[model samples]
Target chain A: MMELDENKKFSKILVPIDGSESSFKAAQFAIAIAHKFKSQIICLHVIVSPQPHEYANLSGLVTPKQIDKIIFDVKKETNLWFDRIKEHQNSENNKIEILTDVILTGLTPYGEITQYAENKKINLIVIGTKGKTKLKKLLLGSTASGVITYAHCPVLVVK
Target chain B: MKEFKKILTPIDGSEHSLSAASYALELAIKFLSEIHIISILPSKIKYGDSSGYFGMVPPKYFDKYKKEAEMWFEQLKNTIKSNEFNLDKIITEVITSPLSVSSAILEYGESKNVDLIVMGTKGKTGLRRLLIGSTAQEIVTYAHCPVMVVR
Candidate 1:
């Protein structure tokens, strides 16, 4: 008979939310995993510049307020994402304690996300990919690909 | 490079571990490989003196270990016996102390030359895991073979 250890459980899971449908799906999957292991969820959102510095400089009238508005929109979307998570948890009768939402503002999305996971000692990262085609992904540099390459923790990229 | 032909899973009797085991079984079926399950006894047991009376030691500790092991083995055996899928082969091993869990697992994988290592994560964070980092993370970073960590 194969003997197994019985006391193991997942205590934490890091989830990155982008307010997209794919990210929401990833959150659903993360919630299910958390319920199964009675693990805590770290919901993170990285606020990134939609345009690069070179591009921003070219578009002269865009003020800091515009950037703040973008950040505010992302935060509002993240809160909506959490609201959906709460609804799912209540419906499923899950008892796992999820940590409060985390919002990180940075220029590099992948770097900030990876650094947060490492700093927080996150064991698993659940992320959603837009699932761009090979050429498109190469040209655009998808966040998921960057995370898979740089993240030290195990990453589950939900399509 | 050749695809993973044989895989070893170290089960810790937790639901998380069983989920990992189930995932391994599914992969084996897909890849036409074999699965080997292993359980390790902690190193503390080997260094401690056994001069005390048997009754003096906590019987529950022994019983818990035995019962958990039996349960996991039974699950694996039944899954194989049912023939629900083409698993190719299955094996199990239980090792008592004298080695740390991580080292034992690494040694077993190295000796067997398995293509992959699959295990469950404990998902610990912060100062709590400062000294003892996650086994899954360590294995993924250091293992010669690719590791698939199931949450």
Candidate 2:
């Protein structure tokens, strides 16, 4: 007596890609879910380095304009990635609109993910855990833990 | 598009769990997937009268918890019944585990080969994470399949 309601839908889905294998797997799952719901997918790429220039010796040499341009370029690169993904999804009957974002803030990956989910009213967040930043011998990354703890919406974590 | 076939949902009879069940049911209805409701009872009973006594819990000690959890599922069934979804393929399971709840969930889910996991989390404050680790975090750490943690 089960029914698959074609009317049931997801408005917005978020996936944070860190170029990790698990993150790409999460993107695959997110795209599938978004396709079923006929919703939009937002692929987020957070620059791990907030102060990229500070890491470099040219602290005073690079102006804020240069930094902004750098951020824009990163955003463009992210856009291209999402665009390719969207292109691949076109073969499927369900068309999923993809929006790409490159966040250059100092907030941790989890913090940025949760904040974006909240601000965008995302119905679901699909994230991947690389387990690289885990503290103990066996555990999730601290950032994934934080997002799972703090996000107001539902989170789908794929490892 | 990848559609879910089997969804594992753990319920604790808490508001958070109820919210999670609601969301998971929505997805299940959309996917026409079977919903498996799993409730884990603590090996040691920690009810109102027992201050901090830790001992072997009798079978009867878990009956009440099981019933309460069943009631929660009944409510969920009603919610689903009223909705357009004519689905009634619900599987209920209860386990008394000495291991942590998250560990039990991962073990059970693995045994069943569930495709997806949808559950709730009452996350502790930053300070509490330093002391008592969260079950949601542990499940996310170890679950082989995707886990949907609902607020």
Candidate 3:
């Protein structure tokens, strides 16, 4: 409807994805914005490493090898999500660059996401209202709220 | 591209809200969007209560706030005009409602089929250094369409 301007641009947009349909929707929205602005999109997924205490019950059964396997599986799954989004991008013939990052950390997902945005100097963040832990009763997910609270740049929350 | 056909931006004449307004204008210029700039005043009169509480609020209270909203709209318009952008499709309204500020904005946005809501991270009553204002938080939580919180 309008022409792009040099001053009003979202050069870099971050889309934090969890393995949820809502997050995929967010990614789609980000893709659309990227297509419009000719901006770069970074899809980040943070894997919250299970606390050591949680493994107390399965101390005998769970080993470091098992934890590695679990992390590997999670990484694989996260990659699939990236691929799915890439497929959508390709389907639309959108050539905007999409970069995917997976972070394994003990910190909360929101904390990590905000930190990454700050580190990357992200201009905008497009996130879902709810994440993998749907919590239908709560209108917004804790991670989404937390990110909104701490992010330094503008946040576009996709429903 | 997903075009934002209509964008709703609620302002309270605060510095943060002004910044959000400028951001919304930028986006609207880029998307050729019809901008709706609304100022919402929380009704001074309390509803669903006794007649005593209902009559406590002065009759001019709402009128006074409505006039204030008009001033804000004028100031915003001047600033936009100074920037030399086309304001042909821009709409400005003052909403006086018994509902909370965030609720009123959301209701109007939904009724208008607003494609995106761009608002400030804080309002006039927001505390400095606070993570986020309650009104912005509530809007982001409840709005059906995409909401952009400008800082």
Candidate 4:
């Protein structure tokens, strides 16, 4: 392994994305931090597939063709989201490099985030506290908390 | 004007804690700030119960902790001195609490009027954290200054 130089600052910053307003705000923060530290921003968006018994937006009688169409639509939506981010970056004159990943995972968003951060050797993680689901918080059982508790790197939970 | 002037960094001497300290030292170089390295002594037993001895730790354990704390601070001080981060001032301290260590850390930061806090997210065991609660989250929740958490 090559030795790490002492002067490096935030070599890799990870942001778990959900394409929500809060998550976008977190990306904004990540951008600013990256500019200061000369780091790369890793934007991660986890996609959750519905279970067999779980409710699908379409009717239960949906065909395989319909499922394929849904997948295509989802990928397109995610691409558009990143395109908007590129537009924002250009408008803000921010030169920070951003890498976006749309992942398919189980329902545990926080667990996936923590694992990804560690596996990627992420220096820092910036994330929004509340997710798409507005479920009641279990005291400190928020997604941000879960990532903060278990993450190998430091986690910034934007409120 | 540079926003961060005095930075407070709390550590548990874990691998990640040292990394966070180095990051804080880098910030200190940026702003010509003072870095305060502190280690909080946790209360081993669970708190908030009337049945248990409240606000008091066993004297024998306290004495043992006091010596260990001094050694930890000395080690931290030596590390800071050896580091070539262009940092002019570094102060190391150890805070002891029988309960509510997180709140105590925050209160200490407030008292010192530190502009920012840098800490590691991983150090204490998950089970221990579950019993006493997450300190980093508590500090983030209560701190008036901006907190930069390092892994």
Candidate 5:
């Protein structure tokens, strides 16, 4: 941790991206905060369940073509997101570090995000909420809410 | 109603609380207000009962704690002075009773009719804050005046 002067503002912010409109809004918010504090932004994206499974008991199948397609799609989308962030970099002189662009083949998004944040020692987490319907959110718990509950640092949930 | 001209900041010697103190000083400098720094002392220090010839600490231990708190306040004052911030007053209150920290701060802020309350966030999250929330959070929710949280 940097030795912070009591009057100094925030110096680092972590933003999670999922390529949604709300996520883009959150990115914008993070940019504003970073500009205010002269802080850097760390952009993160998680790739969950990259492979398909077809099994009733012990049978499973995944074609090479399908795996290649998933990997390519993940890389393409991630690059597009990075390009969007680069657009904002033209105005600020702060150092922006692309900490991690991960593709985790797992089912637990919340747990993975929490673990990554803990490992990184992020100052703050900025996420976007889909504002899902109450019933939908209850059944398929929103990732943003789950992250807020589990995050160790302050979370800003952009609507 | 008259605008608030005085503010009271309670310090616990924690970095979070010191952040609040810095924020309070900034606001005082902006609003041209006075600030009072207060520190409370817990009623008892529970040491083990006498088993051998050596015994637990005497009641005077509480006095020692009060003296230490005053010294901290003085050091804090000197630091602010070095920074060239003029503080109208610095107060150190040693409350030995079992009083709620949030309530004490709120009561003092109200009594002084402060326009704003500034505090620092302890930065607790997840299951750790399931039952016990941060004092800054409690103050923000219950304070009569606008509360600024400095993280």
Candidate 6:
């Protein structure tokens, strides 16, 4: 019984990045869509926090300070990716609005990405077909599939 | 990041596909892209036999289904006309393929060099509660071009 909503608009777009080649390709697609629609793009990078089980073996050996350092380094790397995207945008002379977010959480990457999209009221999600996962044999990465299943809005999977 | 020059949408007479069609039309207008609407009909049907013998459906049923598909295209054409879009920019076709629905759609898209694929999250046969239909999932996984799954 669903009817076409004539008011459909891609005002806000969410683009999740894992600093992989495919993710960068997805960002380019998002930029094009954003340029056409004059929409805002939210580029998010979710870093999964190390679970306690594996670190339990290290126990006292792996101090909280060490964990903080690892998280900090990952955040810095993510920032560099943001800067690269911005540089490309500037070179193109496209004035599309781009926002970057780096989140460290205990939850899964797909869960965090979908949650952020919902919280931001994003109307479109442009994601890469694959991420940094080493399983190259997989045609579709697990995270991409998971996000597609859980997202509240329309999803654009960039190859 | 290629421009959206040609957008392909596969419909199955479902409300979801209809909505997705409308969305595709809107984007097409914005990008000045050619929009192709296709409906895939299965050419092979399995009979009531344990043996793996697949044959074409009855000619009468095929004719009936073809007629229904044409009617759906006619309705969609009316919708496009009402919106005052360039009729030449819109192309509608019904394809009979031996492959699965998703595979047929993917092959058509690739052959046509489609820039983007816009499809519904689920079709008529999809369960209401499921987030995405299997066909849509397969298309997203395997298509060379970008795919937009409209909910």
Put down candidate 5 lDDT per residue, B1-151, tens digits, no spaces: 1132666677777666675666566445544567777765433333322332123334597678778778757766655543455555544575543345677677777887876565555532323345224565566556665454544
Give the Cα error of residue B141 in candidate 6, in Å: 1.8
Give lDDT tens digits, candidate 4, residues B1-151. Answer: 1256788988776656666776777767656688898877756666643444664667787787777766755655555444555534888777766657677778888999998788866565534344223677677766766666765
Residue range with the least summed lDDT across 10 consecutive positions in model 4 chain B: B124-133
Give lDDT tens digits, candidate 3, residues A13-94.
Answer: 9999887999998888888788877899999998887766765345545566767776788888898999999998897864
Residues A86-153, model 2: lDDT tens digits = 77678787676888888776687788888888999887888877634534454466767777777877
Per-model TM values vs. the true structure: 0.47, 0.82, 0.86, 0.68, 0.49, 0.88
Give the DockQ (C-alpha) for candidate 5. 0.05
Could you give candidate 6's per-residue lDDT for residues A1-159 as a string of tens digits? Answer: 233344477899999999998888888888887887888999999988776665544453556776777778888899889888777777675688999988877788999999999999999999988888768788899899999999998899988
Looking at model 2, residue B2 earns an lDDT score of: 62
- Clashes in model 5: which pairs? none
Interface RMSD of candidate 4, in Å, is 5.8
What's the TM-score, to 2 decimals, of chain B in model 1?
A: 0.73
List model 2 lDDT by residue over B65-103, tens digit each: 788878877887877665557556678888877666787
Model 3 docking tier (incorrect/acceptable/medium/high): acceptable
DockQ by candidate, in order: 0.05, 0.40, 0.44, 0.27, 0.05, 0.59
Q: Write down the TM-score for model 3.
A: 0.86
Question: Which stretches of model 5 miss by more than 4 angstroms?
Answer: A1-12, A36-38, A50-68, A93-95, A98-100, A131-141, B1-151
Q: What TM-score describes the B chain of model 4?
A: 0.75
Tens-place lDDT per residue, model 6, B1-151, is: 4589999999999988987887788788778899999998875663422332353456687788879888877777766544556888889888876678898899999999999999999999979789999999999989989999988
Ranking by lDDT: 6, 3, 2, 4, 1, 5
Tell me, by DockQ, which candidate is best. 6
Every candidate's fraction of true contacts kept comes to 0.04, 0.59, 0.61, 0.20, 0.00, 0.71
Q: What is the TM-score of chain B alone in each candidate?
A: 0.73, 0.81, 0.87, 0.75, 0.70, 0.87
Per-candidate alpha-carbon RMSD to the true structure: 13.2, 5.4, 4.0, 5.4, 10.4, 3.3
| Pairs with steric clashes in candidate 4 | A153-B151, A154-B151
Please give, as one word, the docking class of candidate 4: acceptable
Q: What is candidate 3's local distance difference test score? A: 0.84
